[model samples]
Target: MMNALESSSTRPYLIRALYEWCTDNALTPYIAVLVDDTVQVPREYVQNGEIVLNISFDATSGLKLGNEFVEFKARFGGVPRDIMVPMDRVLAIYARENGQGMAFPMPVPAASDEQDDAAASPDESQTAEAPAGEPAARGGMQLVPTDEADAEEPTDPPPPPPRKRPALKRIK
Candidate 1:
């Protein structure tokens, strides 16, 4: 007999395995979800208390890549509905690679720091200019020629253009 904690730990894996099996058999596995109520305002969404088959892409910009939250369209009871879920929140991962395949459990979430470090110290390169003793640093700044020192100066503008072209004549 397994303890309650052990059973709980295995539950997600079992669900994933079933989903994969459905995919292998070319059967769509739907998930009945209790969506976060906060997201319902924009779309007038409804959970409808049934697992609906999700048909959407898994492209780079789509839901399957990883860590991306996505909104996809699905039809329930002949009415179109919008469903949003985070990839992390996915309970099952299934693919129809083989007819009647296998499902794998969703992985556990890892701990992460969500806070931004606005007060972190700046990098040395950003705060200070390198010393001139280094050869590389010496060539970094360009020298500008001053008008008072450099003597190759243009004194006058060229003559004005001709008002008209010479008339064409018959050649011998």
Candidate 2:
């Protein structure tokens, strides 16, 4: 038997909940992920070690929000491809329209010394310290909050948007 922490992580459950929330509201769900060797995605679509995917029901087929990974098949540039993203690699899940979403702090992966030396690189150590949503010296840039508004935005905006939106409340 395994302990609760060892058996499951809260990340996947949150992902599933957010996904369901998006679908329930008829919102297009998008997920930003860090691309690595374990990820299976179209290399051409990836930008700067990251990829944002449209995981809406219309875009993905056989979408499985599993505990370990999110597996789905979607088309990229008209070619269907299977995309696999580890739950740990998911940085955020947001609605494409208004950008209401939750950003997850990147989990530090355990260091492994016994792995093949051929795959090891000097830069591997740098990533372990750089949490998601922050920039690293190695030049990997994560999304950081900025106060500057969009340049093209209306100087005098319309009335304020509505408040009191539906949100998931965890019991524990």
Candidate 3:
């Protein structure tokens, strides 16, 4: 029994979960990511490794992985560009961080169901797909600096490339 607001809030999380499920099942879920109201790009862009600015877009645009930092690419004033920021990057998302942030609970497979699926085919056991999507599960928090920090003085210039061996003249 969830209220309309609660249901609405959960949409993004559901979308994310579906995307994960699709990926686990070897399916590609098409996603349209919009940054800053003006620019939009496909989710493949993020998958391809590009930094992008954060901006609010239609909820139907796609699953928003909130509370996490993501780097993506977008256009600024009709020019191609790239940007990076935490999930908390967008001003709108920050405002909705409390309860409006999306969430999707992981689907639990029943033990009997699992057994049935396993009995159905031997190969299925060999290919138990990961439950989550990209950004694999991590055991512990690791601090990673996004920008340069604690600059160190250069100890020495980079070693130059090895010179080619001189050709030897044939003896007469």
Candidate 4:
């Protein structure tokens, strides 16, 4: 549990907390984002790979803030569009009225050469075989390499399994 907590990024938690704070005070919540190839937003609205968005309840619908991404539907120039932003791309979340909020460091991805060591060789036999979407296992799980072509590819994560409540029973 401790390891999980430490490994977990605090960006999502802080974003949710600040959003709630803004709404409680009747202030508009805004987010500043660094738009990368993975970000799904209106290209016209983005300038210099950065965009500021109004994320208040009135501005968005079906807002789902998750550990890996923030998903929502919002209107842009009278047209509704879906927006998906990776947690790492979020630079700051603040109240538009007072500009009071927190900013986080954007984690940089590792170099391609370092990440694609397993697939660098053209010879198929020389490369280790692993099923699609499954990470290579050495002694433990290893991170999978990502390609530039997959930058904007959306992932459909499986729903978490339901949990059963514990029950006490008498045993001989």
Q: What is the lDDT of residue 115 in candidate 3?
A: 74
List model 4 lDDT by residue over 72-133, tens digit each: 99999999999999999998888887778887875555556434753666464245555555
Score candidate 3 by lDDT.
0.40
After superposition, which runs of candidate 1 have C-alpha atoms over 4 Å from their true positions?
1-3, 6-8, 37-43, 47-172
What tens-digit string does per-residue lDDT give for candidate 1 at 15-116?
455655665566554442334432321244333311323433321123232234435555555575565654334433333332232233433323231112
lDDT tens digits by residue: candidate 3, 3-79? 78665444345545644554455443433222332233443444323222233332222334554433345455555
Q: How many clashes would you count in candidate 3? A: 6
Candidate 2, run of 10 with poorest lDDT: 109-118
Runs in model 3 lying further than 4 Å from the true structure: 6-8, 33-64, 67-172
Work out the TM-score per prediction.
Answer: 0.29, 0.66, 0.24, 0.63
Q: Candidate 3 — worst ten consecutive residues by lDDT sum?
A: 90-99
Q: Candidate 2 clashing pairs?
A: none
- Deviation of model 3 at 111, angstroms: 49
- Tens digits of lDDT, candidate 2, 109-158: 55353244326765564345654655563333444565666545777869
RMSD to the hidden true structure, all candidates: 27.4, 12.2, 21.8, 19.1
What's the TM for model 1? 0.29
